[model samples]
Target: MLSTKEHADVFRELLRKGDRLYLVPVPGHSSALPEQLAAIAKNISADLELVETYADVFAALEVAVEGEKKRAIVLCGSLYLIGHFLSSINN
Candidate 1:
């Protein structure tokens, strides 16, 4: 999810151990930087990866999928981030 660290902290209970989390920065917006979000994930001992672009996200997703096992991918946080993701995919 592309959100602030504070927001994640409040909803941190939703995170479980061993979850693979990829943190991406939302440039020029009021969101948690990747490093900031990574701190929270590290606190819970979650597997975390920081990526710079949507390309990196897709690359990570490709590696994350094991065989034919379907995995749920969630893209959340602010409407701005959602818009950014949608715009990226459309292009």
Candidate 2:
């Protein structure tokens, strides 16, 4: 979806305002991956922007919620991002 201008714009808008923005990308791509998926794949852009580990992500969330009456952290992506997030915490 990031390859499409409309979808990409929507995604950008969704992350524009927040205490912190993190993008946890899938680690690697296979040849079986479609071209659009491959085009948007990278760890450095999403890679470097993401917290060093998922624990850092949760820690960021705890800090983020400190000032708000109501707040939530929205995590998006496939099982990959969630798996990465969970595995980091489990380890």
Candidate that would win on lDDT? 1
For model 2, residues 1-91, the per-residue Cα lDDT tens digits are 2122343444444543332443333444221222333233322135323232222345545655667676566765445546766888799
Q: Could you list the CA RMSD of all candidates, in the order they appear? A: 4.1, 8.6
Give the range where candidate 1 is weakest over 10 consecutive residues by summed lDDT.
48-57
lDDT of 1 by residue, 45-91 (tens): 54433222333345545655646366566655556766776787899
**Local distance difference test values of all predictions, in order:** 0.56, 0.42
Pick out the ten consecutive residues of candidate 2 with the lowest summed lDDT.
29-38
Candidate 1 backbone collisions, by pair: none
In candidate 1, stretches whose alpha carbon ends up further than 4 angstroms from where it belongs are 1-5, 8-11, 45-68
